[model samples]
Target: MNRVVRAAATVILLAILVPLLVLSSAAVGPAPRHWSGVSLSGWELPLVDARPRQEPGTVRAPHLDAVTDRLIARGDGGWQAVVPLHDGSVYVETTRLDPSLFAELGRDFGGDRVSVVYAPLAPQVSPDGGGGVPAQTLWQRTDPLVTWATLMFGFPWQLGAALLLTAVAYVVAARARRRRAAGTAAVPAG
Candidate 1:
């Protein structure tokens, strides 16, 4: 390939590969095993609770050994519960629900019940939760093919590519040696 062409290709490849590997690595991990459910309650601050439409609620998990209470904040689309764990506090967001289900929860349950799933073994993204968990575990999110490819290849396409390049180089060197020997033999031992 031309020098400029090769460099451009390399840059483009790096751009795509870097993001893909990052996202894939981030995605690769087993989901949390334990989940806790809490109910949202009215806040003590009158202004906080009575923000017209914004009803800031507090979720208390007295049942959970790890957490006693959490201040659930109202987000744009959902609620974020800042639950304190053994390590630190984690912001758990409520998963999206059906429109009817949401409305029913709002009407009947006052949209109090919120399910927060978490992995005890895995690290959390919260600033207080130290850091995120490494993507070492094979049992991860869906897309078996992608996971398999990522495992087989490697980050930035290094490992498998190195092996392939080595094999190709060896083959080329062997062919050159054979050609040199054949030429020597044709010269009648001169």
Candidate 2:
């Protein structure tokens, strides 16, 4: 391929991928409610189960284990490390947990407990709240930049590194092709 063509293709590919990388990173980060949010700490709840939280009406795909599936799902992701609290179980979003920690939660799902520092993103009153009183609600990890950083290293970095390595490979292949062509041209021919 021509050098000009390859360079143009690389530029075009980057234009498409950079935005995708940014959008995806933001999508997987803490929900907007977690931005500048406060969290309740020193709370420990017995773990019930850990699984991907399927939104209503989403296509049902084959279920894979928790961590790898979430890593692949990226932006379209949700996880629940269910724990009993407030006289009922709350779907604690495990999106913020490190992959190792998330996997541990899954491993310990039914038989162990999890200590969490969480914030409720929204509260829905239990129907049995006795006259419209609010009940404990969905829990989310507090949105600190540091916690969000862990998620950044996942999809964005993986994609970025892959793109960069591809570019380097292209450059090496192009150079090797040029050297081979130059060598053939210098040889005596009948």
Report every candidate's CA lDDT: 0.34, 0.39
Over 38-87, each residue of candidate 2 has an lDDT whose tens digit, in order, gives 11112223542222243444442222244334433443122333333332
Best by lDDT: 2
Show the colliding residue pairs in model 1: none
Error of 2 at 7 (Å): 2.3
lDDT of 1 by residue, 77-186 (tens): 22223343332223233322123323333343232332232121232233334244333332332234443343233333334444465557658977998999999888
- Locate the minimum summed-lDDT window of 10 residues in model 1: 32-41
Give the backbone clash total of model 1. Answer: 0
- Estimate TM-scores for all models: 0.24, 0.28
The number of the candidate with the highest TM-score is 2
